[model samples]
Target chain A: MPVSTLTDPTLKDAHYLVDTGFEHGEMLTIVGKCEVDYDGRASSHLAPGERLVILKPDGTLLVHRNKQRKPVNWQPPGSTHSARLDDNRLIVESVRSSPHEELEITFQTVVQVSRLEVDDVSDLELEGSEEDLRQRILADPDILETGFNAMATERETSAGPIDIYGQDADGTPIAVELKRRRVGPDAVSQLNRYVEALERNRPSKSVRGILVAPSVTERAKQLLTSEGLEFVSLTPEQEDISQPIGFSEDADK
Target chain B: MPVSTLTDPTLKDAHYLVDTGFEHGEMLTIVGKCEVDYDGRASSHLAPGERLVILKPDGTLLVHRNKQRKPVNWQPPGSTHSARLDDNRLIVESVRSSPHEELEITFQTVVQVSRLEVDDVSDLELEGSEEDLRQRILADPDILETGFNAMATERETSAGPIDIYGQDADGTPIAVELKRRRVGPDAVSQLNRYVEALERNRPSKSVRGILVAPSVTERAKQLLTSEGLEFVSLTPEQEDISQPIGFSEDADK
Candidate 1:
């Protein structure tokens, strides 16, 4: 693997694209001061200042401040990364197709740039949680097999947070409420409020509500039917894989 | 720089320490299921499951689950890392000295291991908000420079969370309440609650209250003095470094 470490004075704008290969698992780390504005799920602003920007081979982009271990802002893996120079500033954008997340960072000045040809991968370790399961459903659209195209996840309504906002195959608006456990009547009531709020705010027509959980009780199903809502049960592949295999003292033999 | 990608079928325990050099700018990523127990700062447990683990050259150890982009647990840089085989598991440990944080991960199985020799870094970019500023004070006691040793951050009491809990050089128990903006009387009231709660809970003697903020007004300072509390003002290093440089239309020309 080859490594190139260059100072800002020696770096050309084309180096972000032509000089390094990022898709082949190459890594790029840039240290600079930047003005960052994120307009995706939410809008945030970072005044121009000294910041560390990392572009990884796996398509993870992180914007870090000197004080915290965690990046102040970042786009998770599977986001598409593009680096381009605009006028006097270098612009890097990371876009995610599923959740429609986009992070744009504009570097006012470049202090340094280093690119590494990364080849060491039997496979990079990737982990996921229930949120990932929701993302998978959004990305595939067919995971539900219910012909639902998830429009959004964790979209906020006046009433509360709608776990999944989408439309049926016929383009009817659908709101989904997610739960890691077996949902009950309280969950139904919460979903009812969210659906009511959505419909009240967008009152051109009625909106549909859907309760999503690993399992839904019969009582909850009755409530859902009474409320004119739907249900979707998801069993993540890792759910079964993550269950611990029981061991006993006798098993040591 | 040499890169090594190996599978456990051909990996020996000694190779974790021998086959690759991690002290130099190298990154080691291990993927497998592990039972993890973290007993520093706070105690957390992770049942056996597939997980991603990363060990950086700077001694930052991260244990990741499949749910979120962030690691489930991690230790900051400047920690010591050691990997070895214990019983039927692979044990990885990272130990940090200041404020003392330790993370231990036991890998139940090994799916893949990759070591990368990295050569790229000019400077690190750092950013942090008020929360980050408070965390930095908690993590490094020496930052106070007031002979105050921060014991724990955000320690919960009946009233609320104490920003910093520690002892002064004279061995007096101190409870700190942090605010990023100018201190006000409401902050004093909150700090008074936290201090009173701490003293009530551990009541052999009284625990003194301290107000920490970026800047304190004269009225707030008078209130603190009247309440028998101390005040510490901080202007984070990152704060000055992060201020945006002015660029006018003339400059654009």
Candidate 2:
């Protein structure tokens, strides 16, 4: 294209393929375009052509970007939190990539301000009342909260007993008791101890006990079934135990 | 243990397990102590009976923290950065869990007050003089200044060419035209075009051509090798070249 053609009004709103002249990542500046969404980087799908246009706050535009846009060379590394101007929060859903490994995130600041945020696809679909939220937390396949502290025969001291607890959708309580390999007479005894301790304290009627493991010992399952306690097995399918949760509170500020 | 025996004089400057009467991960106030260096967290490893001590910047002690460490029971959602002391700067080495994978860090204002700066780890271990530094950049494994730009060819409107144009260690000119994949007859022809275009405009013997890719066609490699041009073959080790050779200065900043 001619130099004059590059300055044409038609291409003003379009994204110009600016070469950052760096190595390893792709960096592009939309002449007059603001990103409406984030498709993985490096795909030309950010929108076709080069153009510039002023956008009103209330105006909406349809942008078709190549899915393969990547970072241009010399660009710093970072993650996108959100793609929309109005949307300020980015939620990254917990994904299990390896067996027997828990995912963790570390940052220097507990909070951040960013033009980008990641939305967890699974977390977006949660909907329901308090009862539904509670049920969802119990059956959530992604996380399992167990109550081990409740099974202590007695308070060994004020040090406190170990307790495994997961919250329900409406902030209810769900306690789970887990077995390492198999459940047997010992598990039954342990469960009895926990039930008795919990009964003494009577934390909440909504607080239910669940026994989870890869394979429940026949005796443990039988005990739980006989006791009428609910139980679930671990699986990869993300079960909605609650609503989409995040703590980006710019509105309040 | 009796409160009278708590003030033992034998324990000084040695690590001791403070009976933090609370759970792990919870913040505790330093209440009482004899003399020791406790970073505020209490470990469970006390030798039957040991006292906890905390040091302070001023001559006076802060407080003794014991029986107050609470275990981290809840992870706040969307909190990305960790807590830093008043005198420390936040440096993000890498992002742990993210939607779009990239490293992130920020330098806070606190470090500026403390006169702390980012460490140059890459340059520390190497024993290099001024000349060596320049020569090292020219050599492989040390990425000095490299960039990419669109160059025009006679047959093509424009082709993406990687440029390794910079000053050598000795302040001499340094420039190279590199092809990411295979070098074809057109590539050789293309390099000649770039060289001529660059030489005609900017005369420098430091400008050269480099063809980089996996194994090239035998004939193509022969031709490029014979012309005294550089060939960066894709060895098994080089197959995974996603990492940059040198750390960017801004990466840790």
Candidate 3:
């Protein structure tokens, strides 16, 4: 809730009492150029340079460069840390005892240091899953077409989880394979396996396999058609997948 | 960027130009609940409800429910798209021909729509890579210690890329392995292999292997100690790793 900027670079024996209740407790933000040395599985080092160091509330230690999506190097949570300013430098040490790993960051020149306290649960959280998407299709078959009606979701097969099990207007058993990406060869193979298994188990009717995705690959199409399967494109609406189940509060106007 | 809101429940025959000139082009922000059908990897459908669909310039389409970082279901880029308002609904379609993938987003009810345009490059860019970190270490021997000096980086052998190859203070041959996560059993095993290979090839001198990462797993530590290795911890200053290279201008002041 409160933030303080460390004007004086040197600090020692400082204590911060962030809430213990918070899972990811406090974050220490520091900007400076310094030497980086990591001692854990293997010993390594980095030359002194200008960089930003963020000590996460959870014991995860992250080092970032100006560019990239992933931290240059990181230590997962469940570690203890201590920072001390001595001999005109800031020395911060973090240790994880289970693996017996340690991190030492020496700041040759400290520009700024601040402690961040998480105040509220304003962060977004979505409880979205593959099953949620399947349930949606089972609720409405018109999305696929006027004739398509999903009989079941998560149909168990020897092959794997069949997203949808349904029948066409003509009463042919349909096995649907669902994925987020364009249909690929692997999906086609999987659908074929399920269809073959179903057909062998129930010879009275022929089972049709349909590969469903937002898109389909040329390879997938060839594979699907050659294997006697169908393709359907479904675009999911842009919505938060994290909202609680049956919670449609955002667009409730 | 000009943004617009569609208050009308029904939309028909709408056209917008989201240029491919932008790497991640235009982001179409839509909020509402509707069915999501992806006909690609496997046919998939999501029951219509409140969610966010983001169409990126790079052809990546993302559907989100409020709290998750990853899209509930998404279609990757490298596809063509066309949007039209037919009857009282909005139809947004994306297609990839190579693998033949198509994603269709049908909005049964429209609540909001916005287009995002990126127009500036004032961002911090880091040429962040394990190689970059290794280069930094190779450039500065003092980070390792006063007596250590790095001889080479990415030293090629049957064992793979040696993060750092150098000599300790006593001129003893040292092989270094670097990783971003807690050192694991695999990393230790890898280092042991490299050391064994290096020692077998060069019999007269002793070769010391050091495993370096932000932290180490208990198993990794045990493995490293049993194999006679050293560990060091390095925490890099956090910077934006998401920025493109040559764009490091944010903290350049």
Report the number of the highest-lDDT candidate. Answer: 1
Cα lDDT, model 2, residue B8:
16
Q: Estimate each model's TM-score.
A: 0.35, 0.18, 0.44
**What tens digits encode model 1's per-residue C-alpha lDDT throughout A172-218?**
88887777557666677678767877887889978988776778887
Pick by lDDT: 1 or 3, better one: 1
Tens-place lDDT digits, model 3, residues A1-253: 3344443244441222212212345555555556667766445676666554556655666554433333344565777767766686777677888677777777775555545442222223222244545655677776665688788877886444577888888888889877755555556666776787688689888898887677877766765766688887864432455758767867786
List, residue by residue over B51-150, the lDDT tens digit for candidate 3.
5555655566665543323445666666666677666667778787766777777777655454444222223233434555566576666776678888
Order of all candidates by DockQ, from best down to worst? 1, 3, 2
State the lDDT of candidate 2 residue by residue for A1-253, as single tens digits: 0010122122212212121101112211122222221221111112212111111111111111111111111111122111211123211111122221111111111111101011111111212222332343345434444332222222221112323454445555445555433345334434444444454465555455565544666655665665556565543233456855565576548
Tens digit of per-residue lDDT, candidate 1, span B116-161: 4443332333433467667678666666656888888778876567
Question: In terms of TM-score, which candidate is strongest?
Answer: 3
Error of 3 at B49 (Å): 1.8
- Model 2, position A190, has a per-residue lDDT of 46
Candidate 2 residue B240 Cα shift, in angstroms, is 5.8
Candidate 3 chain A minimal-lDDT segment of 10 residues: A13-22
